[model samples]
Target: MLSEEITRLIGKSGEPMILEVERGAIRKFADAVGDRNPLIWDDEYARNSRYGSVVAPPGFFGWPVKWDSPMPFFSPIREELITASIKAGFSRIVDGGIEYEFFHPVRVGDTLVAVAKIADIYARETKGGTLVFSVTETSYTNQHGVLVAVASQTLINR
Candidate 1:
């Protein structure tokens, strides 16, 4: 069961955090994921492609962030949400899923601003146990003010 306090947290929006997209970071991430796609790390290959330049893989959109200063990244927005849940008498938390809508490709040297908001909260009874789900919506915008991507993530806690 979910408490009213937690329910109140739903629809709460957080400040936007700036995420720098470096070409090196993109290449390293590609290497780490074993994704040998040249378009993701090779400028020459990407130049030959329609994109005409190196771009990040879709998976980077869901990269994990840490609890830092001024603003919070949606990927790790649960930092505060987890605190609220624990205060609401929840103990464990796990990722349910993520749904992403990409408007533009993440290119190197692009700095994006991401804002996270608690979209919803609900309770469900499963064969395993009772679980509470928190849905968060993270919107990403580039320095050009272009809406780049939006991610809806569901977190399960018990």
Candidate 2:
């Protein structure tokens, strides 16, 4: 059974992170995702495109937070925040899905600031198993203070 105190832990926030998008990172991601788009790797190709210099692909912002490093690490900010909102005893945790809305195009050299928090917590019993669902709403803004993206993650803890 989940405790009331833990259930009341909704709205708790985790450490905020700031990330800087880099050209190399964009190229790496493009390659990893099997995107052979010349614009992502070839400067000459991207120069003539509407986005100008290499632009990051959509969902690239879903990657880790890198302040100045060439490559970012999975910080698990959403998972950590959700953990604090759930009581002990969950056997498994899996990502249900993420609803992401992009407000601006993420470009190389853009610095993004993100904040993640536990928005809701609840539990239900199903024919398969009893599970707790934790939802985290994270909003990312650019250094210019303009909202860049919002990612809502639903985690199933069973």
Candidate 3:
């Protein structure tokens, strides 16, 4: 139940936050996600793959940088966005779906920055009433600005 004004305000552009992806971080994400892929854990197997090095799980590319900084957004954009939606008065918000496009394989020790933007917002009338759908797109890039992956997530607010 975000106020219309606040929703509009949230639609406005904000500063892009930087997130560094490290080796340990990727491994932890793989473990948390319950994806025990050899490419993500076995360096020997990874070296034999097309990537020629340790390749992170495709979904693990979204892991964020956990630095001791005052800016909370530097943590994880996905979690922050969901928390913000709840705080904005949404009685319940669920992750509807996610789509990701991979341009390059994310490897261990790759420092990446995730730049996120509100891609779209709309509402639909359902049996439960009007539900708002918010789509956010995040692009992951390495320190050199090489695009690594693009992730689009849909959140359903009711």
Candidate 4:
């Protein structure tokens, strides 16, 4: 029961936003995830590994960064999807799950861009009530256009 306008808005996926990877940001993200892996925190250890420099954790790519430009229409893509579902007519909503596919390690000093899209939308009737779900897929690529990682998140509505 989402309004057509809101549905349309949510459906419009914006262009990818580019971001620069910083050593400090990577360390912060590692700490936030409580991952103290030497590969992420120690340059000496990282240099000897296959990756010549410190690399970010797979989950670190999901971190948000401040941009100088006006924020995109779908500010927080996940939240926008949930709000859109509510506006359409769903009474309750929840975060169903997230699935990630890593293509390459996010290395320090690599400039990356996040290109996202609404991959799918569907509804079903359950014992609890009617449920709607939206799947948003985001692809992260380095400046060289190399695929880095892809994250698919599902949002559930009831």
lDDT of each: 0.78, 0.74, 0.70, 0.75
Instruction: Give per-model TM-scores.
Output: 0.86, 0.82, 0.76, 0.81
lDDT, candidate 3, 1-158, per-residue tens: 44564355344434565665566777788889888888878889988988777767786663544544454543344455556667766659777998999988777777777777777767778887878787878778887779988888788987
Q: State which candidate has the highest TM-score.
A: 1
Model 2 RMSD vs true structure: 3.6
Candidate 4 wrong stretches, greater than 4 Å: 1-11, 62-80
User: How close to the true structure is residue 51 of candidate 3, measured as C-alpha lDDT?
Assistant: 77
Model 3, global lDDT: 0.70
Candidate 4 is scored at a TM of: 0.81
Clashing pairs in 2: none
lDDT of 1 by residue, 1-158 (tens): 67777887788888777688777788888888899888976679888998778888874643333555443344444567777788776778888999999999887777888888999999999998778899999888987999999989898988
- lDDT: worst 10-residue window of model 1: 62-71
> What is the lDDT for 145 in model 1?
93
User: Model 4, 70: alpha-carbon shift in Å?
Assistant: 13
lDDT of 4 by residue, 1-158 (tens): 54564456446575677667788888988888888999888999999999999998885663445554343323365456666777667858677898999989998888888877878777777898778877888888987889998888887887
Most accurate candidate by lDDT: 1
Name the better of 1 and 2 by TM-score: 1
Q: Flag regions of model 2 displaced more than 4 Å.
A: 62-87
